[model samples]
Target chain A: MENQKERTTIVLFSGELDKAIAAFIIANGAAAYDHEVTIFFTFWGLNTLRKDEAVNVKKGFLEKAFGWMMPRGPGKLGLSKMNFAGMGPQMIKHVMKKHNALSLPQLIELAQEQGVKLVACTMTMDLLGLQEEELIDDIEYAGVAAYLGDASQAKVNLFI
Target chain B: MENQKERTTIVLFSGELDKAIAAFIIANGAAAYDHEVTIFFTFWGLNTLRKDEAVNVKKGFLEKAFGWMMPRGPGKLGLSKMNFAGMGPQMIKHVMKKHNALSLPQLIELAQEQGVKLVACTMTMDLLGLQEEELIDDIEYAGVAAYLGDASQAKVNLFI
Candidate 1:
């Protein structure tokens, strides 16, 4: 096994704050264990990679509505549970900070620092009418085939 | 590497319908690939294992309130998103049926039939005021140590 390279692939399918945090935590943990970690963000998960500032891009009505209704970035994501009209996430974040836990953005930065590869799904971007400029810098872009190529070789593949 | 055992451990931490479906889907997929898969249900995830029938168990005010607020079993669990005051889950279920996808209960049965080990977290059971008789039969029960023991040797470890 010493000659074998360990790899972990995570298909991040959820854009909720807690789920995104879990994905990054797992990716960072795998990287710490000396495994090559790749996270493929698709559909709603792409919101995590979106830039906080709204980009000036032209789009159809529905696409623009989606862009407006959905969370713009990690900071704007709502909690999967107890989201009492958007107040639950803020309360949770406060509790997390009180306990000295890393914020979701901090976790993303840490994962990147630990060499965890972040890949945005190009198909999802197209469907959502998201331009590359609307996303954060320092990330890769690919489709599902590229993700499956990595997943096929990974000993651990998760759809989160 | 050829001689190594392929083990996958999943920590089911959320009780939401969508998350539970994802867990079973992943568990079944791993089993299809001949991996030894274990799903440890903890905290809210234990709600998935609850029987649809309400058990006659006495509890304190807070515990009774907790039980009342949370969904009783997999059949009653809500979706993680688009839950429009409970209508969204039914809508999603209808769509899944239309697409010939298995319901959450069917997925659970399939996963078990495929030899996925379903383990209930004993600590969570105690914390949530749940009893052994309230859950489905033929599943294992243990603490975090047992889960960590499996996760340590497993090639894939996920907290869903």
Candidate 2:
């Protein structure tokens, strides 16, 4: 069981706010069990780990133009087929709040505390006009090939 | 631009109430613009589409046993980081509500009215002991192969 725990890691691919949150959720859960966690933030997922910038930034027209159409904030993400008009986001936020789940800011803290490896996609940074200085401190830069190399060894690899 | 609209399709992946609301917000927006729409549900996502299930169900040990380690409702989901101690789910809910996003219930109605394709995961059904009868009548069942087969051709595919 100890070996299994150590061996288990979740490789996350995220460029969106909600997906980033989802990766953190799983990372926090795994860390709660004392598992080694590594999150490879590629493409848009790098936004959260960006340094000196707000974690959640509004998507630009270029992003929208490329068919990346999701909203900027967690509250703006669409649910799977069960939205109550525009009310699904509120209900999720409300229910999560009632249940004492961690907010976005706290998740970041927990991830850091839990020793989650936050990796940023270097290629994405180059394409998006981001620099290493722009990402949050402690972020590692690697190519997708490197991410896949790490992910291939992980027991749990999630493309969030 | 017109071609882009036809290529755009919203896929709802969260079965949770709040996430579902988020999904609807995008769906409604897409529909209002007359964009092609398709929603795919998997895992817990299938719950929202359950035909006769109540919006509120008691969470048992099974939920903990299952993958749901967090609050089972929208309010408990912790929008940013799953940090609920210093923060409150109600506060999150309030912020989302103030934003005029869809409630869990409202999104479902909008999906139906807007003619979104509701696809549920068969694999999740087997794992959760859910049957087609347990789901809302509007859902269609598809295995991963089937869902991917359809999604492969989609210009836009969202995980929600």
Candidate 3:
């Protein structure tokens, strides 16, 4: 018998790795329930979708001045905030390696394995001067209109 | 010289246990960082604040049609979603137990221990016909205006 599937869609608007991780966790959790899931990555969230650009953790005083103190790319995230303090970023790297939850890369791999749809926001790409070739191959391009269409039909719509 | 303190706040928007667990995780994570944290429960998220209500796990057709289920209260959630697969709720119950993650009750207890704020939504209470007496002892009442006023000054405002 064919099973009826429920759709879960989320519009993720984050450029930070930590924020991205939060969205991915929820997506993965919902997918585990066998729901058809779609994630629309807009604004900063689109950075993780870049194919050639490595997810770099931000660093240094200048970056920190601009609120870039968190790890440069998607490589550093997931330690509970309390655990993040005291331990240097290097230690975080080691722990993440041990736990296998290292940033967007692992999340991307997991999302692919779990069949979560990845959509990039064209508006963000244009604003960031990102070309279509810059995004990861697994990603599909969609404008806000397309994303809204998907979101309208979803049983659950989340903005994170 | 006295230093400025970093503020912490967690906003929980979902009535479900898994969503509630995410809030607990973030709340505890903040508390671990020695930041003053607050958890604002609003709308459907009020399910966690209901002292008499237990966690609702979706059992297949039998439980859905009938009311037979496990985990007497919110404290019992995450059990089925964690490990149970074959024996119905039993598999879920086992998986959650393996992780030692906080159940709703335990999470509430931990919030108490950590001095995490548990703010109940005033409007939701009136809408749902919930009285103050129906809630747990640690709850406080705040309107949406109050929550947003505080959230504006907060470094992080999460809707979980």
Candidate 4:
């Protein structure tokens, strides 16, 4: 039993930089511990997977407004607290750099390099009018069923 | 092996109402599924465990200031997003009530009633100058080791 590999599934629900950092930190830790890890990106979480550059996608007015209002990518995400009208995230980034900690993009890269499965939710994409081209390459696209399938077999599951 | 009881551990690290609701919802779901569940409240998360009424406890100026700056209890906690000077939480609560969803305090009560083990981080308590008497009764007090003990065996572990 001790030799059996563990499995972890995380449902990334929040798009805030701090929460994304926590998710990646846990995912990295689980991967380091020899666990199979999967992160399901849904709703705002999918924003973290978006590329820094905007993708030209046709959309209705509301959809376009959503695209405009929400952060385009991980770098634009605001902090969950002390956001003083957008200054907090920059301050946190500076702190992270000062401490030589990995940035969100770097953490995402590390997670991918460690073979962590990243799944973008199809339902949310449709609702938010996000296109696949807007996100980074090499990620699986699935619905909640895919997430549940992984979660059912997981020894560790988290919704963050 | 199939008959062995599965365990779930949640590290409730945020005190915001939205996050707290999510944690309780997940905790309740796990408990309903017959998983042995534990929620380790640390740092800001301890604010959720605080009683609404102020306790007659003495403290230093900094300690009192800390208490004053933070939400007194779950009832006073703000939302993580769209918190337009505290109106967002009230609006969300209204919507929750309209949808017949459990309120945050009710969810906490339900989680407790469902046999979820609530563990308060002692180190964070000392750091924040929180006293046991100020929190809701019938909770375990421990440090990181206790949380790790639970997490080490948990079939589902979450940092929320």
- Best candidate per DockQ, number? 4
Residue-by-residue lDDT tens digits, candidate 3, B1-160:
1374444466776665555755675576666666567889877677677666533543456433322232223644441111233342343233345545345577678888988888999887666555666568866899888787766555545676
Name the candidate that leads on lDDT: 4
Separately for all candidates shown, the number of backbone clashes (residues 3 or more apart, or on different chains) is 0, 58, 22, 1
| All DockQ scores | 0.11, 0.04, 0.02, 0.20
The parts of candidate 4 lying over 4 Å away from their true place are A1-7, A17-38, A41-43, A46-149, A155-160
RMSD of each: 6.3, 15.0, 19.0, 6.0
Give one digit per residue, the lDDT tens place, for model 1 in A1-160.
4787799999897988988988898898999999999999876788999999989988876468668877999999987788787899899899999999899999989888988999998855765568889998889999755665576567888878
Chain B TM-score against the true chain B, candidate 1: 0.94
Residue B38 in candidate 2, Cα distance off native in Å: 25
lDDT of 2 by residue, B1-160 (tens): 3455453344454545556666767767767777667676655555556644233444444332332432333333434344365265466566767998656656667777887777776645544445565456666787554544444344445666
TM-scores vs. true structure, each candidate: 0.66, 0.45, 0.44, 0.66
lDDT of each: 0.84, 0.57, 0.61, 0.86
Residue range with the least summed lDDT across 10 consecutive positions in model 3 chain B: B79-88
Evaluation by lDDT, superior candidate among 1 and 4: 4
Could you give me the TM-score of model 1 versus the true structure?
0.66
List per-model TM-scores for chain B: 0.94, 0.66, 0.74, 0.97
